[model samples]
Target chain A: MNLDLRLDTSGDFYARKFQPTKREDTLILNMGPQHPSTHGVLRIILEIDGEYILRAEPVLGYIHRMHEKMAEVMSYPQYLPNPARTDYLHGLAWNWAHVAAVERLMGLEVPERAEYIRVITCELNRITSHLLWWGAYLLDLGAFTPIMYAFDDRERIQDILQRITGSRLTYCYYRFGGVSNDIDDRFIEETRKQCSRMKPRFKMFKDLVTDNFILRKRVEEIGEIPADTCRKYGATGPVLRGSGVPYDVRRAEPYSVYDRFDFNIPSYDTCDAMGRYLVRMDEMQESIKIIEQALDTLPEGDYIMPKAPKKPKPPAGDVYFALEGARGKIGFHLVSDGDKSPYRLKLRAPGFSNLSLFSEVSEGVLIADAVSILGSLDLVIP
Target chain B: MSEENAKPEKAPDKEKEVKKKEEPQVPKYTGYDYDCFLAPQELLKAVTKLDHADFFLEDVSCVDMQEGFQVVYHFDRFSQPGRVVLRVMISRENPEIPSIYDIFPGAAWHERECFDFFGVRFTGHPNLIPLLLDPEHQGPPPLLKEETALKDLNQLYPDRVHTPVSPDSEEFVKEINNCSNQKSRNQS
Candidate 1:
């Protein structure tokens, strides 16, 4: 026998750091920076004692593209499309957060109609994000049919958005002061039709998935996170709402024309994965209500601000603009020194804060239950 | 121990009142709910006060400038929704501050990310490994201050005046106490 035997000891950074402390009873497992169940490039390190997880740590930066560094080097206009790539699921929200932060710092006034367009498109994009999360989460839990149903509604909404915004996935529709293009009659009419169409699909989703008893057991009471835990770990979106706190960034800190929209922030006090699941299921309906209301009260004016600068050089100051993304509060902390490029552009990715609680939540949970809890978080890792 | 004592209290209506009393006295920064600058040492205390006030830590962001590195912590309330930002300026040479992970457990990853980028160390962070950066990452921190990229702090924050804060100054502690006492009143 070899004096010192190792399982090919020389590996990458993560592999070297991931050795098992107790070789006899404990096993360490790596679960993909390239896995489909992860939704994106998320690698979770799990230390297991038989079937129960003793500890779990997420190792990130596999896909870190240095977007913050890009924001510094790229001019203001050149950096417009970059934010969308950060959270591709709710691209518009990130885009709006960046543009809105710049606009606030510059003191530029957006027209009434432009604000409404921003509201409508952003909400539509949010519905798409939730739909995908719904479909993908179910797929993660061994269900394949619901994704087909979800994509049915998601594609149609994306179709309406594409005709106006000119992109389906990573949208750069929002400009500094307003939207890139005006929403025509066709876009509004088609959006209204889709909103009406999605209402019943949600009912069908409940009957097909939410009502399923097997799904309930997998989620309910599994990975239970109390309201105090959520606050301590700073988890937001449905994760926080599910834990019984009715904190919605839209209602909490009203930004743009969100105050004009009337929609309830759905919350559940169960503090379980099932609670988070229900909160999101109900939120899709609330988003639809917002879209319909905005269309009814859609004021007539230019979608893009008339005096909006082509290459904005905002005055020297720091502005932190946060908006309610489909996942949580998306914030853009912009520090400008009267330059076209941001001196410091810190993207407060909601997923980053929301995902930080995974280690605490996954502790003492079954491996399968941990998977369920991760999906319920609705992560769009940046 | 103020926090642990107040935890078992089940009074919902009075919870807001007590929280408001202990909240910090943050200056009214337009667009933000409350804004205050803290010496590097006060970062942990101010954040702990916010955590006790039921405010969730939003993000831990860093800005590299000519003077030093500015670490920004954004927080918001659930019961009474408001944004509070604590800006702490650390000397560029040392670039370390006391960690708030003991208070807000969520700050763990955020602090690591800041460490990965601007190379700002959180003194008490348990796991300060590379979060969003590969440990094999070469060169200086990706967002390190390049000569051409640096901006004067005064020019960057034209509207807000920077009053240098000594780590053990009485004025800083008093300001934090006032802000901690007035959290609910911050809603306005």
Candidate 2:
């Protein structure tokens, strides 16, 4: 097998070395830092001999921002903006996780209308995140046009989301107990219109990318992480679903008014990157179904009811809260010593687990095939 | 529970306290077994129980207390709502803890950044390298020190001081200064 291995010496980089007595005759090569396959900034130092080979070690912390430590200093309200930075592609979803966490701690109830609005916006954000992944993953496979086509529709959703949230990336919209502000009638109408428009795009996505001969050849049986291993690694979101695990935070955990809405947690038994790609694409369609349901059943009430404290102080207890973020289960564990600032805050990011499987799946695959596998994983950020 | 334990034996009260603690331990969702939250304070011991585990070391920053530093360890379980947190208090003289990277292997960078910003040292970290800060800076002990606001951060970051000198003009001035110094030396 032909391998396009490029050595990056710009930084102090190292790979896992094996001794003759320990493990003999294994060739290793670096995969990314700038490799187009690694979705965002990630460098996986792989140890392989020829096409069929060995161990893979992932070097991380290139994108580490001490988000937890930073939360300790910032007030409960002040720390709202930073969660968006963790996974910027799905910034809205991260924001919702933090807000949901704080709301649960303070014992604040989100109104029916607010819950509907939250579900609608979150579902829209989910579809948009998935749409970008669809485009970017194809680009990783060396197909260029689909990215442009996917982005064109994704921007329409961005425009709608941006009006209420402000700023394209790193949205701080969902506040404690409710949203920062209510979406106007125009926002609601446009969202309903967007859902109708997205259904046909899903069919088109299936026709264009899913059924393509080249795409199938590249993804069919490549980069497979078995269901047992996926469970062992604590994989969530599409990564888990691709392994035929029917565990979704929305369905299983039931955050917000998700239990009220009807949707299926789609899974595939294939357990490859292609399975992951297909599952996410199908999830976007499911998200559209959810948004349509939410729009029709949106209740009539005040968006921001006054249950939340103006100067909130969470009691001295531990609370674990999570939401079905675009990437997966984005959760926060807040330990409050009855202070305005959280005593300790831990964020369980999906990309961290999803990306961790790279070393396992990328072993033995060719350089190009490795990129395809990484692309199929659809890691947003770690 | 500690309060009741301190008091003389009260069987009923002790049982109630144990029940209160166990309620939160139960999985928030039905039909799912989330028994991972019941582990003791040793963080690494809890992580090693599961195979192929991915430790998401979210953040490691210290809090400034009037007396000493309170080191917080936030543990998030991927299974369910049992996100466990463990904390250790360290003195102002020396703040240290055994690194979790041996178990997780991915926490090396998170621990280093924690050391960089807060000066909370991870004792067994393989590479305690500095990240996202100047290598040579005569600043306070750590960026998050109590004296930060009072001190001028720019003075510590002298590389921030610049005049944007033009290369062409700088060379021209160098030649002129060399000629003038030659003339003065010859005359002397």
lDDT of 2 by residue, A1-382 (tens): 8886887534342442321124567655666767767756676776667765466656666666768778878898899899989987888888888877777665677888888888888778787788888888888887899988888888999999999888777888887778878888899899888888877877887888889999999998988988766654456788878888776878655678888888998999899888888789888888888888888888888787676665567644555676777777776766565568876676777777676667667666777788787777678654
C-alpha RMSD values across all candidates: 11.8, 19.9
Q: iRMS for all predictions?
A: 6.3, 17.9
Model 2: how far residue B31 lies from native, Å: 15
What shift in Å separates residue A127 of candidate 2 from its native position after superposition? Answer: 0.8
Candidate 2 lDDT tens digits, B112-179: 65677667787888767564344443565443546332222122111222222222344423422232
For all candidates in order, state the fraction of native interface contacts they contain.
0.71, 0.01
Candidate 2's TM-score reads 0.72
Docking verdict class for candidate 1: acceptable
* Predicted candidate 1 versus true structure: per-residue lDDT over B87-110, tens digit per residue: 888889999899998998898988
Off by over 4 Å in 2: A1-28, A48-53, B1-188
Q: Score the docking of each candidate (DockQ).
A: 0.30, 0.02
Off by over 4 Å in 1: A1-6, A9-11, A18-24, B1-29, B164-188
CA lDDT, candidate 2, residue A262: 86
* Candidate models: Cα lDDT each: 0.83, 0.66
lDDT of 1 by residue, A1-382 (tens): 6576657745567766764556578877887788777777899888899998888888887788999999989999999999999999999998989888888777778899998898889889988999899899989898999999989989999999999999999999999778888888899889988988888888888999999998997898888889998888778888889999998878776777888988999999999989999998898899899999999999987888888999998777787777889888888888887777988888887788778888888988898888898899998776
| Native contacts kept (model 1) | 0.71
